[model samples]
Target: MPKEIAGPEVTPGARETQLGEWRIVALKDASFALDGGAMFGVVPRVMWERLTKVNSDHTVPLATTPYLLDNGTYRVLIEPGMGLRWGEKQTAMFHISHDEGHELVTSLRAAGVEPEEITHCLMSHCHWDHIGAACGADGLPVFPKAQHWCPQSERDAALHPDHLRRASYRKEDLQPIIEANLLQTFEGETEILPGLKMVELGGHSDGISLVILETAEGKAAFWADIVPTSNHVHLPFIMAYDMNAALSWEVRTKWIPLAAEEGWLNLLYHDLDQPMGRFVVDAKKRYTFAAI
Candidate 1:
């Protein structure tokens, strides 16, 4: 049985705020080492290191593989964490460990969900770590029935990537899904199901996407690696992993208000301590993380 990890705690006597009615699930909770300088963009180490735990090697600890649920009809998985394909060198560099079963199959099974149960397999982008588990050990579609969605431009970039971007696109990790004829490309905003919508956010990676779920309570936007963690809520805390830093800032500026004004619960893919939360703007117009 999958052990239940504690959800974010609510203060005593605090009224329950219904951001949305979806049944959210945390699939896998793990960490990755990212260069501290890259994680904070232009922010100096002095300011960024205080918010995250940085090792002597200057890598920041960020969460991996968190997902959500929407009324049973839709099972949207944001990013599948680093999978089993990494060799010793890569593994050691990223400090990858299989002890927690961060494997997508294990996490999904633990949640009582089979691959086929996932109606839509959303990609934050095609970075090897994010989409590694989209295919299995052998080259085949992990989710046989689900459509692997990405923006048209990004799909093109992945297929015919420039030399600079090619490093992140591991052929072994994605070829199986492509050969299986399971990849589905989309442009702009797309509604995969009744209440589930995919929004295009380009920055961290090409064709980066986020899932927005509308329910009786309100709406929830799964911000995959865009606002990767609670620490990244600030506008300038862009990732070094992003291809276009300026564009990332543009996307974040636009989405922050849309989330707060519309009361969209912000679901994060890599916030180790608090994976999901709502964005609140205080009197000073600064954003604060309200754990859900």
Candidate 2:
């Protein structure tokens, strides 16, 4: 029998109290290091580090929680985790390890859904960590029967990656899916599945994507890597991992309100502590974390 990878226990929050008919499954839990100065953008590390502890190596912990929406017909997986493709140097640099089985296949099976059953495998972006699990050990498409959806611009960028981003775009990670003919490229807002929409926002990476799930309760936006954690909910908490910080700020400003007003569940991809939550306007009218 495979060992179970423990996920963070859910705490009672506003969403559960109000919206009652949604189910969430944590796909994988993993971490990586990012420079402290870069992670906070212009903000001083003195201020930002106070909120969350940074490792000695300076990279903060990241999680990949791929939500499974079984709306009867569709079984969708939002961004899969960084898979087992790290070399020694990469592993040492990022401190990547999978003792608890960071395998999405195992996690999904435990959740009662098979890889072939997945209707859509949404690539939130082309970042190595975000898209690593999209392919498998043999460098082939992991989800054979599912359509791998990514933005057209992202696909183009991946094919002709720049010197700075080249290292992150490994052929082993993406080529198999392309060869398998499972890659389905999309432009702006497109509905790959009924009630599930892809919102195109380009800042963190070129043509970064977000998934919107229309549930019986309400709409939930799987904001991949944008607001990676609950701590990043603040407008100024832009990641150093983002290539274009200015554009990332712009996207956040626009989406934060849409999240607050409609009470949309902000599904964070790498928040170790608070994986999923709803944005709230506090007493001072600033956006804050209201975990679900």
Top of the candidates by TM-score: 2
Q: Give one digit per residue, the lDDT tens place, for model 2 in 209-290.
A: 8888776667777888778778778788887767888999999999886787777767777776576677777666577777
TM-score of 2: 0.89
Clashing pairs in 1: 38-240
- Candidate 2: where is the Cα deviation over 4 Å? 1-22
Ten consecutive residues with minimal summed lDDT in candidate 1?
Answer: 1-10
RMSD of 1: 5.5
Model 2 lDDT at residue 213: 74
Runs in model 1 deviating more than 4 A are 1-21
